[model samples]
Target: MHLFELTCTAYFKNDLDFRRSFETISHFITYAMMRGGLDERHTKSGYKHYVFGGLLPLEADKVYKKGSTYRFILRSPDEEFLTALSTALRQNIDHPDFIVVETHLNRRKSFFITELYSATPVIVTSEGNLFWTMEKNGDIMQLQRQLHDNLEKKYQSFYGEEIKAPQNFIQMIEIKNRVPQNIEIHKEGKKIRFFGNKFRIVPNEDEMSQKLAFTALACGLGEKNSYGGGFCLAGGMR
Candidate 1:
């Protein structure tokens, strides 16, 4: 699978909280797809061919005001998807206030090792409630299982292929800088809020393990990835 990264430089049109950045960026992406000729059904489908990371170089506690420059990353396994998004961004970013200054697309190589660091909060939903990695009784093993199942489900939805869960593929998952935050998101014309935590994952050796690791990088780790949760970077070579 090929992974493409869209590095964007943008400025907010108004003062905004960092918590809302994910939703704002999510809307921007949808607008781009529509401008690129994708219909609403395709853009809003269950298949998430892309996942986004959080805004970079900003303090988690700081508010982003107008004219503040920031960068964010988008990842996808499909080159065509990235191309269409880049084209739309260059033409026009739908946000009335937010302006896209510059955009760049880079083909990224998947790390051979199976370690990753979460760039955004990894979210999981249980009984209709959002669960963060660090808040679930500090059970790392259970969290890894949830992440593994989520990845398999995503593969099936996106690729129409089911992958068997590799026994004990996730060797360790470490939660660092545990910060609890609530994000306000507008969905289906109504505002909603979700609470979650940000964390990291470390995996063990095996072909299936490597595949899962790469898939996480491309499609994100836990739930709500398209909404800017579970974004990760390669931890390093094993």
Candidate 2:
């Protein structure tokens, strides 16, 4: 099933910037979902979004690119839709997080991804629990820094190597939020770049959108149902 059903509903707080609020959204959510499963009938400015596979839906979303793009705006919720939304979120966590466009941030009449935010899924296990983050941009950056510092502390406490830049982190909690700020294709034509964060692209000739959407789904990107089933709160990234 498409991760989000239209029944989802969600809220957007005014960001650190006072002029506007995070875009409102509603959609169904599926975790660790693979995009090759969905339908890619939709196209964004000539890109395939959702395409159909046998029984599953191929993913349609991808990290936003500056020129080639797939963009949608999150609109405010009206009364009736808002009420029905409360029941929807409990069905799953996908309805709560989204990499939606914000108007004020874009500072334009049309949509642009001026902001990137998500409410990702978390499964607590013995290794350590993981959680989604909703932080002011600065805070998120700081938390990333702390992760590096904590790594250093651990190394120093045990290993004796001199401190250096942290190693690349393995990608988890996929976010095809913003399109890559840069791109490069290799021998097999696989490409990689950044959305709100860094990512790699798999190659596919037949269905371009399908390829991108699959990338998004694999990375756990897209809109969520607003019913609030999987709402996550991080320990402040900053």
Candidate 3:
């Protein structure tokens, strides 16, 4: 098992609103995965220890590729899930965000990125996390702006246009022992706020979205969706 410790850096207001918004983003991932016809499952240990999401038990001998564009080899998973994820990613209208079967942690950067896909349009990276289908190649940083706008709109829809997130809750991680702390989690109006900065918030729904992503991961569902950060999912999980 991996050892994780919370990095106390950022802050959130309260647990109520934090939980609400956090859950919202996670559900979107669940919807996308269901649209791909897959399920996720997981078991929880304490508040931080989650078993079997990205790291699962599967065969490693399987080999596959997508023309000269990509080569995929599985260390654990079989063929079906990879196929679904590949198809979903390659079929992107805006830059498609696909994932590799085996994910490696960049110890140097203290972050993780997927294995390479060939013939990739070589679009420059951005801050937000947006991209295009071969031709569009929009920057992710710009997408972050878009996500922020969409989130604000979403919040306004329910909380009124006057609803603005408090400055205290910044989407960033404070890593100590490779674990993040002070995560800003939200579910509806009630949010889960923290005082430390162990958690890093990538631009997106963040806490909630990651939960849903973890939800999909647990269910073994694969599809195209904007994903950020390592997270845990327990909703509708088995």
Top-lDDT candidate index: 1
Considering lDDT, where higher is better, how would the candidates rank from best to worst?
1, 3, 2
Write down the worst ten-residue block by lDDT for model 3. Answer: 113-122
TM-score of each candidate? 0.86, 0.18, 0.23
Candidate 2 ranges with C-alpha deviation above 4 Å: 1-72, 75-128, 131-196, 200-202, 206-238
- Looking at model 1, the pairs that clash are none
1 against 2, candidate with superior lDDT:
1
Question: Over the stretch 1-238, how does candidate 3's per-residue lDDT look in tens digits?
Answer: 0112111111112222322332332343334345555444212221111112221111243222222122221111123444443343233222122222222211111122111111101111232443222124424344333434433443333224443443312243222223212224455767653321112233224344433222222221111112212232222212
Q: Model 2: which ten-residue window has the lowest total lDDT?
A: 49-58
- Candidate 3 scores a C-alpha RMSD against the true structure in Å of 19.5
What candidate 3 gets wrong by more than 4 Å, as runs, is 1-28, 40-79, 89-180, 193-238
**Candidate 1, number of clashes:** 0
Return whichever of 2 and 3 wins on lDDT: 3
Model 1, span 84-187: residue lDDT tens: 77877767555765877788999977667657887877777654464644555566667777888887777677667777855755777666764665557987
